[model samples]
Target: MKHPKVINLVQEPEVFYRIQNKYDRIISVLGGSMQVGQVVNSDIDLIDITRRGLPKSVVITVSLILGISMEKMSSLLHVSHRTIQRKGDDELLNVYSTEQILEIAEVISRGIEVLGTLENFTKWLHSDVRALNYSKPLDYLDTSFGTKLVKDILGRIEHGVYS
Candidate 1:
């Protein structure tokens, strides 16, 4: 007889949060406004759009929201600064970059909500966090693993865990 494999739900936050966010809100944050016919109802809808790649304008918008420079944003995305600067805002990035940008956007959205204000969250992102070995949260934006760490920290901050 064969048995089914078991997986830990806590280890799969991406799947867990699939329906927790309104993709429309993320689109609104990235696009700056809700455009007609651009509604996103679930992860499936978002994945369809993201697989086609997102506009360069999104990186620009998220950079401004995080209070960082294009150079810093490029570093976080593991994209060269020149590459980003060479492209026009309306241009599309490769799917890999688009996915990374989306992850960062989710962090920012969650951070702002949990930390109260955008300014506070922006400050927190740049400042060294003691719980993170005195490292700035910006240091972890480069990889999905690190991004998850930042999100976990945000959750702790929200619950007043003081870490």
Candidate 2:
């Protein structure tokens, strides 16, 4: 008689997270906010969206809430010091910090399954400012609770879900 194979749940964060996330995505899809394929495709699109929009917002929000300097934020995000100035807001210097950019980068890096080349990441970072603005992309933030939601979203994406 042969015994069935046993699955170890403690040895792999990716596998553990994948199952947990798939369950969560199933529930969310059933709720009608997303389709089944979208959940699966999210693995790819999330990296795309993150590369395209999240970094700037993460840097901006963190700097704003922490009241830090843009030069610092740039160094931390590995972006040019001029990037913040280009945001068209003098106040941005008072909001972002180097530490915050590092924190956000670490979080985002974990979810990037198919990392583009450095040039690709840089190009993607500066894309479609008009779309980013109209998405009211940052409106999801206003308070600590909102920030928590952003963190949660990142966690979901890392795990392969959105909830």
Candidate 3:
């Protein structure tokens, strides 16, 4: 019998799919007259947008997407609710606030993607999570570490390993 030819195989360091997430295209989280054609496709794009600042309407849109009140959104951004409400829709938010809002939108997008719908993800956000020591995921929204934790859990849930 002839010896079989063996082919050396190497795995790719990163998987490349021709397809990309549609979410990155619309970035609907930045709602209100945002042109979906201009997508946030890279870290540099994210940084540039952050430096440019987001409109005040982003806060309102994200709050609605999250089904939370502006008062709650205000507390998360560490700003007065009145200040947020007083700002015009076209007014740009401060860099720090813009960054925070962007981060939150990222998490929201991931959660919705993983959970299959915004309604389901919103419910999950408010529900107490066992891995989070019975604290609601919403409670973790105030801190960066906690937001990361939420993202990790969402990843786990996506992979079917979240117990």
Candidate 4:
């Protein structure tokens, strides 16, 4: 079965709050309230979010939520550790890095659906898995191909397929 489009945490107050509990910085970026007269009639503008580039805070928030370190985040984005460290909290990541970060967030949203909680999903990400040649799921998060592989595995798990 195909997974649903990930909710726009920026637009959905409930979902945003839920995520905020784990990634505290999200509230600052997305704002504490849904904007006045904002309509939730359609899916989130993934292109726009990517084009605008994600703030460095988003990268840090996601890393913390996933229980991954800043070093791991740098490797995943193929950016240097020092460069990531040098960026200001509000600085925007480049388009490529922003897209990858969004992709990871989407995956985390899906994983939560299947695994029940951020804590469980994060644990799964860090643990070795038989399906991935005994490699931790996080080991493959550094590249597009690997991200796809990990997503596929999550999809399989969601469908109750033995990996």
lDDT (Cα, 0-100) at 8 in candidate 4: 41
lDDT at 17 for candidate 2? 29
Best by lDDT: 1
lDDT of 2 by residue, 30-60 (tens): 2211221222233454443333333243455
Largest TM-score belongs to which candidate? 1
Candidate 3 lDDT, 84-138, residue by residue in tens: 9889987888878877887887788777678876678889998989999988888
Deviation in Å, model 3, residue 31 alpha carbon: 1.2
Clashes of each: 0, 3, 0, 0
- Root-mean-square deviation of every model: 10.2, 16.5, 12.0, 7.0
Better of 2 and 3 by TM-score: 3
Instruction: Return the candidate ranking by TM-score, descending.
Output: 1, 3, 4, 2
Give me the overall lDDT of model 4.
0.67
- lDDT scores in order: 0.72, 0.36, 0.70, 0.67
Tens digits of lDDT, candidate 1, 16-112: 2232344533554565323212456568866866787778877887787777899998998889999999998778888778888878877876876
Error of 4 at 14 (Å): 9.8
